[model samples]
Target chain A: MTTYYLEYLKLKKKLRSWLGPIIVFILIMVAYPLTVEFLEKDLEKGFYSLLWISILLSMMFSTEDIFLEDFNDGTLEQIIISSSSFPFMIAKKIFIYWIMIGLPISALSFLFSLGITKDLNLSLFVIFLAMISSYIFLNLFVFGSALSLNKGSVLGALITMPIALPVLIVLGKSIIALQFGINYLELLLLLLGCLSIIISTVPFIVSYVIKAHLE
Target chain B: MWGLFFTPEDFVQGNSYRIIYLHVPASFLSQSLYAAMAIASVIYLVWRVKLAAYLIISIAPIGAIVTFIALFSGSVWGIPTWGTWWQWDARITSTLILFIMYLGLISLHASFSNYEKADKLLSWLVIVGFVNIPIIKKSVDWWSTLHQSASITLTDKPSIDPSMLYPLIGSIIGFFGLIICLVILSSYVQILKRESTKSWLKDYV
Candidate 1:
């Protein structure tokens, strides 16, 4: 609880970190319409694909300095020696990032969906889909961020991008299923299951990875 | 050459199917080598065996080359049989992902100067990436794909004719033998480079 609040406050101080991804998301959303020649229906067609990719890119950017700050300040070493469970701290840190960056991106996904598709039900579903998918991407890129701690996030993002491609495939399929009046819930449930597994394991793996870096 | 030139052409596809001899073996070895690396990763992580670590790095480039051959040859075979070079089918896409993984593994290791840290990180990535292997194996069954399912299975009788089947098995074994030699040669180079500062390595070389 204390750790959670501390992480939240610490991240809260860094306005650029959280606000930057939202701006990136907004830019990507706003830019898509300009790139297309003012075709409303065509803009609708490609909106969700751009939405998902933009969220992924923003999440990648958000985590670019996730561990680097603490690592550079020797704070990570202090936490490691503090007798606290290191993985728990890492997991809590990811949760705060989700609250800050991922939550807003998901909310914007709803507005963009409604603005473009103008379908209330589909936009609502987009909100839920974006919420879960964004969290999953956050956890994944955090793991990537941990792996390439000293190296820049590009290498980290490059290596983990393949793992995230399947999630994008699922997101594409789910949207199609929803449009066709099919059972998209199964796909949503699949993402939920995937999120559960990744949430439990990534922090544990990342703790060891960061420890390896410090060694 | 025996499998390519001498084997009887299929009744339907004819001479175009000859590439199967190379494609099947390369495809088989590509997946097989990753399974081997995953096992080596497990061994290295659990037992901390330096040789297991060495094997993982040694197998990575060879795996990448073989996976490329599999993709290229599979593409060549696709032109005649599937009427296109690529279809984004599950098997093909997953194999392409596998090829990317090999390169990712190699590059990930190269980014780090510390060999020990690189090996540990590589082992974890290999294990996580192993989830794709079973998907690639069962992709045809899982999805309605254009690619064919395995004609050869350990428990089931072979669906292919004996004449084609025999040479296919022979070529797979032949490829396996060739890959083993490459792994040995690669491992030797890995050992020499990693252990270059050691007195034993100096004397042995």
Candidate 2:
């Protein structure tokens, strides 16, 4: 457990060093609002809509970092050789990656929501759901990135996103509903079910693929 | 078997219904091709079998062609029966998505110059996208969707008339044979391309 936290901290440091989170924040938090404001007169629908869209794109941008850098730098091999279990290491890396990427994006999304909808509670709900969905998505993305370690970035995203579509659709719809103040309990449940599946299954999938790639 | 080949005397659509021969088979082969891709992807992921990658690349274009035929014929059939060029029926929509997945695989494979990376990426996509096929197939049945139910199956006789069934089965067999031939031929080409740098490919190339 302590090891996992330490590994998580190390990953967070690496992500910060890579400057991915900073660029993603600027793209989602700052640039998105400016674009929406420029596009529409009302800026209400445009603001809320672009906020979610920015979150999705930012998640995608960070996914490429999942395995590529480690594969390139040979740190992945070192982690595999470490006393720490490989699956645990992978879970830590994914968790940290999701935290660094999803957390800030979700925070910005909440602020964006406040700016657009002007309802703090609803904004928090939207951010909460988005954060959960993004966590599941990042796990699946990490699994795919590991499996397709040899594949190029664009192809990897294409492969992963289709499988991840159900989750994304449910999340997107729920966020839309939340913004509109509609009851979206069913969509929320569906997204939660998907998140549960990812949590339980993704580690095994990642481990199996990593082992296969090593061989 | 002799009677099976003979056309029914009381046929309504006439010999042009014979196109069902081509259409049905193409549909069957397309589904089979997707199934094969799914299975190959699983094996590749599980066992890291390079041959599965070759099989995926070989079958994808053929699958795309089969899917195209299915949509084209369905549109043609729709014109006569549904009084329109196309409808957003469950079967059509699902099949369209399947076609998109195939196109996705083809484009993904072509995007990469490195053959090895292309194989890995496409295999992953194939595995992931194949999960949606069953969902697409049952979406109509599960929901009050517009698509028609499946035609032929193990426990059930086909819903269509005998006049339609015979040619449909014949075309299906022919299409299967043709697709098999194409897969084998293309797989040979793939082998040649990949192994061409080898001394053995030198003999063939």
C-alpha RMSD values across all candidates: 1.7, 5.6
Instruction: Show the colliding residue pairs in model 2.
Output: B25-B172, B90-B147
Report how far off residue B22 is in candidate 2 (Å): 5.4
Model 2, stretches more than 4 Å misplaced?
A: A1-53, A107-125, A147-152, A172-187, A207-215, B1-28, B44-53, B71-97, B103-125, B142-146, B151-159, B191-205
The residue pairs found clashing in candidate 1 are none
B1-205 in candidate 2: lDDT tens per residue? 3223466633554444445555667766777899999899888767988888888999999899989998898778666545676776556766777887788788777866777766765666676577677766666575454445677777998787766566667667767887899999998888877777899767755
> What DockQ does every candidate get?
0.62, 0.26
DockQ of 2: 0.26
Per-residue C-alpha lDDT of model 1 across residues A35-113, encoded as one tens digit per residue: 9978888988888889899999999989988999899999999999999999999999999999999988988899989
Query: lDDT tens digits, residues A15-83, model 2?
Result: 553257437655666665565445444666556556555555566667766777777788778877887
Query: What is the per-residue lDDT of model 1 for residues B141-193, given as tens digits with 9 covering 90 to 100?
Result: 97789999999999999999999999999999999999999999999999999
Give per-residue lDDT, candidate 1, residue B16. Answer: 93
